[model samples]
Target chain A: MPSDLPHSHGRRQFLKLGSSGLAVALIPVSAFAETDDMLAAQAELFGDRPVQTGRVSVDLPPIAENGFSVPINIQVDSPMTEDDYVSQIVILSPRNPLPVLAQYHLTPRNGLAAVSARIRLGGTQSIRVIAEMNDGTLWSGEKETLVTLAACVVL
Target chain B: MTTIRLSVPDTAERDEIIQIRAMIQHDMESGFRVGARGEFLPRDIITRFECFYNGDQVFAADFHPGVAANPFLEFHVRATDSGSFEFVWTDQHGEVWTDTASIQVS
Candidate 1:
């Protein structure tokens, strides 16, 4: 049946449908899925507000030799002016017993929305950072670290 | 008693962004471990930290077990005036440790 669509239209549809169908049939549990604690923490922090993933950078080593002390740095792209500024930054760990790794409150006086510090990881997992602006917008970024030695979770 | 080490430029130009680093001796007990008797240890980590430039709060952090022991933090601020920078830390046991450093801003 010849249609107005391009020749690759049918192939594109087939590929999309085939992959989605295979996903439903084969992968019942995906590691990419967010944990309940992570979801709840995000919900509590964002409160149904959309969190766009950009303008935030999370820098951590790809492989941490020890989970007890890993240096991490986070920066948010902001002018840090009086009218517009980054209000808060939160770090959450899904694998940790307590999802909250740390919370930082910033203001225009800070002149920059950046911080560096050392953190502990319970295991190899992704660490998420959320930045809230003074205008009520939220942006986020994440970094994954593989820890050779896992540490105890924070209860 | 916690030994607090703070570093800040002794002098800075007006409106220049100044970098500050602070470290303290802390065990940062996670309370996730058990003793020989199998009872969970009580949390003994720093609960809060705040940095004040002159007198206004410039930066602050709320800690959790995920922060490594002997907490070290580095942040920045714009020098608006010649004054002192004060760092305060409060632990889970309601103990507070504070240190101050002076900065000469031109």
Candidate 2:
């Protein structure tokens, strides 16, 4: 009975350590789950298309004083012609309550593929913009912004 | 329910890039916060925005709960012809807010 007691005690300690290790592993896994959701959303929109990392520029303050009203300007370098214009622009905030922020549909009539707006940020995160050209090419730009006063805080 | 203020230049040169700004008075409640009574508030927000020039969509946006209160949007459009620019905002309640501005291109 004395030997059995020590074995049971060791098993209990092992279970305790194992559960703590699992809890530690789960934290990052949950965070990765959010990232997976973001990727899935992107795939849904672009269909696994390879995204080129140029031709689109996102301008925003490197440090945002307030996430509630962060100003953002996006410009895509394109000719804005009937054959070589930006057809669609999508803004995404991966860590926000929603990953997709806004989608702008454009045409040659727009004459420009630039847009400026005030957006809310949940915290310090990257703002990504993607442009779909008339020739079916996809270009992207991203800017990481540090938010001092976090917005979208659920209490 | 909110009031929208749309601003567009009265006149511009043909083919000029004219700036358009739209502002709306809205709280943009994200519905994730708790009320004073400790109850979860329902999310109420503007979901979509579109700009039309001479009956053609020039720019549009899909808004989320992450957008700030009293949303402000500024964009550019080619002043090809003298016509009206229509702006529309749709909310979570399925309510649509609309405003229009006329531009004269000489």
Off by over 4 Å in 1: A1-34, A153-155
> What is candidate 1's lDDT per residue for B1-106, written digit by digit as tens?
6699999999999999988999999989888877778799888899899999878998999999989999999888999999999999999889899999999999
Determine which window of 10 residues in candidate 1 chain B has minimal summed lDDT: B29-38
Q: Write the per-residue lDDT of candidate 2 for residues B19-106, one digit (tens) a residue.
A: 8889999988877678999998889898889998999887887877767788888778889999899999999889898999998899
Q: Is the docking of candidate 1 incorrect, acceptable, medium or high quality?
A: medium
State the fraction of real interface contacts model 2 keeps.
Answer: 0.80
Error of 2 at B72 (Å): 1.3
Restricted to chain B, the TM-score per model reads 0.94, 0.95
DockQ of 2: 0.59
- What value does DockQ give for candidate 1? 0.53
Question: If scored against the real structure, what TM-score would every candidate get?
Answer: 0.86, 0.85
Measured by C-alpha RMSD in angstroms, how accurate is candidate 2? Answer: 4.9
Best by lDDT: 1
Range of the 10 consecutive residues with the lowest summed lDDT in candidate 2 chain B? B58-67
Error of 2 at A143 (Å): 0.5
